[model samples]
Target: MFFIMTISNRKKQYIETVEKNITKITQYTIFNRTFRHNDRKFHKFLVEPDLNVLVVGIGNGDLLASLNPAVGVGIDISQKMVEFAAKKYQSLNFIHHDIDNKIDILKHPIVGKQKFDVVILSDQIGLCDDIQKTFENIQALCHSNTRLIISYYTKHWEWLLKLAEAVGLKVKQPEQNLLSTTDIEKIAELSGFEVIRKEYRQFIPFPLLGLDIVFNKFFGTLPGFRRLCLRTYVVARPHQTHEKKPYSATVVIPCRNEKGNIESAIKRLPQFCDNIEIIYVEGHSKDGTWEEVLRVKEAYPDLNIKAFQQTGKGKADAVHLAFSKATGDVFMILDADLTVPPEQLPKFYQVISSGQGDFVNGTRLIYPMEDQAMRFLNFLANKTFSWLFSYLLSQRFTDTLCGTKVFLGSDYKRIMKQREFFGDFDPFGDFELIFGASKLNMKVVEVPIRYQARSYGETQISRFRHGVILLRMVVHAYKKLKFSV
Candidate 1:
């Protein structure tokens, strides 16, 4: 009975706080404006354009409205906040429901029998009487593919927030539990959700002469300073237990001046799946590589093979062309130079088909390479950049330059749509997919592969020139992914 009474009192306090601060909450001051705007941009990045989204503790409904979801529903404990939000954004549906009272969210008819693509619990988890129970309630509203995004303030800012409230610079709130990112992840785990990505932002919440962007983008993302940030965002999805069925595969081999390996690329490949299509995207080669691709397609009439000539230069263009024409459930990239063996393609296919990962990347650094597989400087650069990218994306990546990558065709379409966020910067096509996968919050898993020396063609890579371009891409990615708005 005492526990029930305590929960009732907490609910009363939250309602009272919202009734008192409804007007003040909507009227954003410079500090609150900057903070909320920054948050909106981050959430916008986390959410795709046209998804069904549910926002818990949907305060004034500003965040939900910003996402441009196909269908948006918001639930809050405060009736006044709900009414105000409904009146403000009549297009979005808002409901007055107490999440702390162990209410099943699916019981509501408006949201009944409907699963969201993204379920957001923003800044309200700390206020819940039982965080575990709150996540359990939310579990009913999620499908396997649904992404749960939670945002909360770091506990280290408790005193500062109290000071701000004392000075009337911030809205006062009821006393609540302060949870760290780890605490939230563990709590969500108990409810059968696994965190896929985590991020820290806003070292300085207010814009102080443009230094906010500089510090938040560069300094706030660094190792020591990131933990001190004001906000933490976590993206999670429902843990999968069921096994996935096999998916047909498309291997896109982009060849340039590799006439000798055209036919072998087909013969050496293992029949990894029931249905496999091989596409030879031949760039303008002087050694009759295009003719060899045609000859190989004719020679291997038993195999499902197609050939295309690149209308534009660079590997990125060739990849985009092949992806456009690809007719398989999953897409795989194989370098024509065959540094990464064709026999290992099944490992890549198995990882994606079994739902072990969303983006399967091949890592040459994991296993010992054959002699002269990669230059010493190239090897050093790959190691250096892998660590840097892992830090940048908040996901582990061992070899960013690996020629073999696999992902579902459906996800590749979404990544292509999200490619405009980073623009056309990657000439090699690896970073394009890597950055896109990270942006889309896809689970990236690396498969170890033994690197072999190229027997037919010379390496088309220039370490100095490409290394400089890669550095530029890092800076570009930082601005897009870390420092925005």
Candidate 2:
């Protein structure tokens, strides 16, 4: 009985301290407008519009309102903060609940027993009484596909933040738990979440016209500098329960001039799935590749095979056309050159069917390549772009130019709908899929494969021209993805 009483007293004291700090900050924000810029930066990178969001530690509901979630609910422990938020943002629902204690989120009238697409802890995880318990409570509001986005300050900036607070540059922070990224990841794992992507941002919070753009947009994302950034963001999802379910696979082979390898490519493909569909998208091949595809389809009568002559130029157009007609649950791309072997298709299928990753890409850099498979200049270019794209997408990729890529059919349709945003610049088709997968917040996984030299014909790629095109695409991505509002 004494221990229970002491626990209750501690809870009461913690709540009172948080309440006092929140009240003081609310007053401070009303007078000082620049303080809210920090929240705006967090909103810019993390929050997307039209999601069903439940923001914990939603102070004044500003960040929650800014996201424009279709179903928005903001929660805070302080009643005064809830009241203020309710009045300021009349459209959003505000709840006054202590997250540390056991509370049924579904039972809340405003939330209406609905599962949210996104559950955001924001900067409030530091203030929670039990971080693991808080995450456990959040699990009730999530489904398998639900994403949890967390933003917190790096412990490196603790002294600088304290100085800012003392000098009246920032709001007075309450006594809170300072957590590192690894610490948060452990807590998330213990509470049934899997970390997907991690990023660091905001080298300078104060806005300057040209300098802020250069520092935050370019310099802050660099390797060594990013570690010292003021904020850290992590994207995670619930640990999924996998079941044995049969999935159909479609292999899209984009061919331009590989006539000699067509029959071998068809014969070498292993029967790995319950149902396999082979699609030959012949891109106006001058070497009778389309005729060879038709002959192969007729010869392999037992196999489900379809052939199409692409009316448009480039591999991207061919992929888009083939994907539009694809019927299988899993969509895969295999270059007709047979650089990455058809035998490796099973590994891609297993990754997707077992729920390991939503988008699986082939990596040629890991395993040794066959003699004359890739030139020295090409290898160096691949390495350079891989680093650039890894930073741009916040996902690590060793070989982004690998033609072998796999994803779901439904996701392909969604990506096709938004393809106009990036334009028809990607002739290779690899970046389009990679960029789209990253934009949709899909888990990207890479499988290493041996790169083989093509025996049928000469390579179609022009090194210098394609390198310039890739650089242009990167700049476009920066504007569309990194610098966007």
As for candidate 1, its clashing pairs are none
Model 2: lDDT equals 0.81
Each prediction's Cα RMSD? 2.6, 3.5
Alpha-carbon error at 179 in model 2, in Å?
Answer: 1.2
lDDT of 2 by residue, 101-171 (tens): 54545567766487898888878787777889889888888987788988888898899889888987666
Q: Write the per-residue lDDT of candidate 1 for residues 1-485, one digit (tens) a residue.
A: 00222346767887787798889987788888879988898899899978999998887889999999899999887778888999999999998776655444556676767799999998988788788888887778888778999999999999999999999988788897888889999999998888888899888898799998888777887888989999899999887764866799899999999999998888899998899999999998999999999888988899999999999998888988999999999999999999889999999888887777889999999888788999999999999999989988888999999989999999999998877788888899999899999988998989999999989979888889999999999988877876663
Cα RMSD for predicted model 1: 2.6
Give the best candidate by TM-score.
1
Off by over 4 Å in 1: 1-7, 100-104, 207-210
